[model samples]
Target: MIKDSPNPPEHLFAVRPNLDTETLLVNASQDLASISDIAVHLAFEVDGAQRNVALGICRMLEGVQLLVNKALDEAYPAT
Candidate 1:
């Protein structure tokens, strides 16, 4: 008989030194915004505690995204 695996293997992530930090921050903010948007949509589909939890998560992500955007702005501001 074959044995079943209970846990998944860990992934090894590569470090990229050449990528721009400002660009990465912008991309991260965009991705998190998308996630938060999805949570907002899901919030409407669920009810009670689950809906509240989703909305709470969405708020937190929005806050983080705002901070990231601020950081990017500070790093590369318009003249």
Candidate 2:
């Protein structure tokens, strides 16, 4: 079950590793791809609103993937 918190802590934050840009991008791309795959699988396995939510997550991840790829291309242009 999901929990909802009203007025959630404003200072909530995660401590990120001190990784370089290329490493961070590679890690994020792999993680997001894994999440997208899981979301796609769960979406097909479920019905109604739950499936819709899962598909929505997949779509958001796809968008992020595109943006990340663009950043990668800009960072390391093709020869």
Worst 10 residues of 1 by lDDT: 8-17
How accurate locally is residue 35 in candidate 1, as Cα lDDT from 0 to 100? 95
Q: Write the per-residue lDDT of candidate 2 for residues 1-79, one digit (tens) a residue.
A: 9788877876688547787787777777888899999999999999999999999999999999989878877877788
lDDT per residue (tens digit) for residues 1-79 in model 1:
9786688556557546798987788788889989998999999999999999999999899899989999989998977
Q: Cα deviation in Å at residue 35, candidate 1? A: 0.7
Cα TM-score of candidate 1: 0.78
TM-score of each: 0.78, 0.74
lDDT score, candidate 1: 0.88
- Runs in model 1 with CA error above 4 Å? 1-11
